[model samples]
Target: MTTPADVHGVREPGLPGRLLTVERDALVPLLRGRAEEDFTLPVAACPGWSVRDVLAHCSSAFTRVLEGRFEQGVFSPACNDRDIAERAEWSNQRVVDELERGMTEAGPVIAKAGGVLDILALGEWVHAGDVREAFGEPGAYAGAGLPSALSLMAYVTCRKGHLSLHADLDDADEPLRLGDISGRRPPARYIGDGPTLVRLYAGRPVDGASYELAGAEAGELNIFDE
Candidate 1:
């Protein structure tokens, strides 16, 4: 694979904030308009989590970020379960309301934390995809925020020291260089659309999508340990 044309493009200071805002505008209304039954739908990407569970987890994380109350093992399974459990008695609208507020307010806190918390924005964006997939709505990972999301992802992947890959996306104006910034190894090759590439990075289910990868294993590309 050739070297990517843009590898350092995701280091924008306000990117995390912009991503959160875009997602809030897109996701909050959908959550508000949905029926109560829709909140109970299972998210195939996030096993054992329904739509409400995912929303609760997302909102709780944002709440933590907004409130500056991160526990030692924050975002871990037990921590997430506790966060969701604490909100179990609230109505779905309340959960969504909190999520909307968190999405709007947490971005500035994340921005001020320097680069340490940049990945939280990416996770929030991907979790939005999980919610969309569960609701069977299109554009799960690809949307208005996709450009910012991809930029943040590039930064996150590089920061986390994942393997580098040169992606040739059908919808992109140009190829993307993601993962290791030092270019210690020859970057792998990826031919696909943006959403499928996201699926690969997030380690989410990719049963039916079509894509080609070379010089790197799919398992090695996952930025999230979980």
Candidate 2:
């Protein structure tokens, strides 16, 4: 049965693009407002990556999509590192400029790929949260685009054939079901807010997150780290 959240529902062709556009409205302005030194802050969610590096990687990834540059292992760590390295000499403004452009333009390209690249938009939004948290901002991982991101996440997790889990989030109107939806595996359980659920799936540090789980380890929820 397809719930309003899209569990067992059809893939939304415009959802990824909409997510990107929504995130850009929120994130690009925030990035543009920060001082030069703020970009140097390390994102704990992505160790060894400064805010600048995250932005660089995001823009470059979008550029790849726009330019149709998907080679083998395109988004591997090595490829991401190479992308960041290519931007090392660019000014901070230049990087942000490219990021703004990417966020604005990558949607159509992603939409054209059908569902193959939908996860990229969700990942980009989460990285935006990582940046927000590094800046000590409240509501780091939750925002206007969260509902859409969560919907997309459920689809991605289910498609990945991971463990099934049912999330009872305090902040959401209804439970979010993720991972293998086939009846062969009973869904695991999670009780928490939406952002913490995102933390689990993204493999971000969640030491202080207040959440409950049964039938599946927290690590098993990770889609990004896989």
Candidate 3:
């Protein structure tokens, strides 16, 4: 794995920018390294996939994006078993090699496209958060990447048929308030602890891990992928 840059890549649009580079250099290696493990540990949020499975899925996702194989808006069934299994035979180096080549190849193609920068920006930011969340590092994306990641995730999840939820949170433990606005309110008001909240919305139960949803009812909202 290449050494991480002192400052993560340029958070710009299109390819060859700082953000994508940081994503390639820092995030991919972290993900690939973990993929080589047995992950006997439980990834409660993912239901079935072990840590390795999540990595494999992510690798395929990056591959798709880099190969110009994406749908217009958002995907209904966000991901399926096919994505998970594709990486099953992959080693860390293999995944990294594929990602490096894909991103490099897609660089020019993205540069010529309209609003491609936004796409690249949003993709890396969101996936970075995904790897962070899957590994239980909820605060990993707590930098300049947070706002874009949160906004894009909320928008995409909504587009994919999930409710536009913004949970009210305060200093209290086990707090679970669902809405779209960010600020003070009734039962509680959410602090800007974004990544974990995003995970909760994605149907990944961060409860007792990164968050606590007091009195939260199951299926209160359909938090599944479209």
Candidate 4:
């Protein structure tokens, strides 16, 4: 395995910056159209959520970030579910209002809480990928923030647990063995190119089981959803 570098406080590379901007702009419209589109979305990735539910989750995230309410990191599964259930019938104007507040306030809030950038970056890429997957876009890795994001995930998982099932890298012949770190701990594995991997490690898994590995010796990998 290639030894991962420590990019804990480093800013994302420039290419991802461009991609991030595009994704940020497109996110609102995608959320707004959640109800009308099919996207053939999987329930497992976002269980108990209709396409509208995903939109609510996004809106809640924007709301939390804008409110400067960083307590408990400003995002949680329960919070997302509540927003989805309560705001299920939100109008486009309502989404526009909340997103406007989010865009207006995100800068200062993030400036005050610099550490949250990692979450923001990962969130952007993962959600973008989710949107792309729903639309059946191929070669989704072309999206920005994916590379470094995945690198971060690979690094974190190595420390948290081990993989039992082998992962077949594109150019490599031998599959990477994925197993548990300790019998009782979670199994580890990398997902996505780099940024996407970081998103998964950060507990998003927006695409659900797309990156899941099977046939592990110790146990299965337990990916978190919040």
Candidate 5:
């Protein structure tokens, strides 16, 4: 449980840089203060995973990227679960150390991935929120990462779904289009904040009234579920 006062030094450029900086400056500090028992608390947003398990998963993902091992699917629950299982023997501090190292080492690799980095950032921010939620803390739904994370999420989810839909994020200035770009037209649109959209994508329950769905069925195009 130590502050990363020396975490900032060489900065990677672009969104990857921002994401890593946020992870180091914001997310890392949050975890540093927690007691050992806190890590065992269940994260409501991520079923079957404890707070430590979520960090282990995130650490493993970053480490894999640093090792140039990338998952093929949009979401790999099995792979993620396996990662957490494999690291089960490690102390909580060891997991955090790995995360910090991986973030530093994987920056160049993430930068080279182009648009794929957005999906990665989305995963990171969402998991950070999961940790916060598990500890009964308010999440950074409106944080610096939200706009880019939501945009990347929208792009990936849109690409995966068969239906075309438009999304207007209240916190964002632009509208997000989902589904096939070549399709004749979209049948529905979504109007919501970044938090609602992220929660829905993560398969967490959201207040029904938080967002609006028009002209199509909602919850049909979850990127995380795929």
Candidate 6:
């Protein structure tokens, strides 16, 4: 099993705490001052989900993590959908308040989840991006959470397959690689900004022109979309 330290290359203590701090700071401010109509806006990254739905899902996830109620699977889109649906009647401000309270209470539990913190942080960052994009606001993708998000992407790719590939991101300090260890090298590689790379890994769309690919086959890398 990969530990949080192993998954994120954590060289210092309190990395999880720092990440939670970043998530809180980035998300809470975005929720403030949002109008009722704003909650109905569609989040491009999460098709069929309104901005309010995204908040409900995020808030539920944080609460679940705190309560030790995670689903049993690699990904749980169904459970996510259920989470949002159950909170359908919640006012936008109520959902935001729940999210804030859950995150505040989840810090210690999340920090103790071994390597799972990466995935948790990734989800928060991605949904935060969704919320920001829906509001026509710029995201804080370049913040303290970027490195951990990148690491989680690499880990997810590795788990999905063993096709060798490399990633070059404008904001990343070092290039990321996967499937190189199995002696099966594929020619195609990804080149783009860190946020775009993370979005792609999370099965979110990136404008085709925003990134470039080189090498064997692009379809081989789509496993993360599943």
C-alpha RMSD between model 4 and the true structure: 6.8
Q: What would the TM-scores of all predictions be? A: 0.95, 0.95, 0.53, 0.55, 0.80, 0.78
The digit string of per-residue lDDT tens for model 1 on 1-226 reads 1222464635677889998999999999999999999999999978899999999999999999988898799999999999999999999999999999999988778888878899988998999999999989987888888877777878888777788888888778888878886868999999988888888888887888889999998888888874
Query: Cα-based RMSD of the predictions, in order?
Result: 2.7, 2.3, 8.3, 6.8, 7.0, 4.5
Q: How far out, in Å, is residue 75 in model 6?
A: 6.5
- Residues 1-226 of candidate 2 have per-residue lDDT tens digits of 1224545446777888888899999998888899999999998988899999999999999899889999998999999999999999999989988988888999888888878898898899999999999999898888888888889988887777878888888888878888787779888999988888888899888888888999988888889877
lDDT at 91 for candidate 2? 91
Score each candidate by Cα lDDT.
Answer: 0.87, 0.87, 0.48, 0.47, 0.69, 0.67
Count clashing residue pairs per candidate: 0, 0, 13, 18, 1, 7
Q: Judge candidate 3 at residue 55 and give its lDDT.
A: 51
Worst 10 residues of 3 by lDDT: 1-10
**Alpha-carbon error at 168 in model 2, in Å?**
1.2
Expressed as tens digits, the lDDT of each residue in 1-226 for candidate 5 is: 1111221122223556566666667777778889999999998878888999989988888888877776575137788878898999999999999987876676677768755665576677788888877888865454656655555555555445446667677766667665556567655778877777677666666765378878765566566665
Position 197, candidate 1: lDDT: 88
Q: Residue 90 error for model 1, in Å?
A: 0.2
lDDT of 4: 0.47
**Higher-lDDT candidate of 1 and 4:** 1
Off by over 4 Å in 1: 1-10
Instruction: Summarize candidate 6's per-residue lDDT along 66-117 as a digit string, tens digits.
Output: 7788658513888888888889888888899988887667767765766555
Judged by whole-model lDDT over C-alpha atoms, candidate 5 comes out at 0.69
Enumerate residue pairs that collide in model 1.
none
- Span of ten consecutive residues with least summed lDDT in model 2: 1-10
Q: Between the candidate structures 4 and 6, which one is better when assessed by lDDT?
A: 6
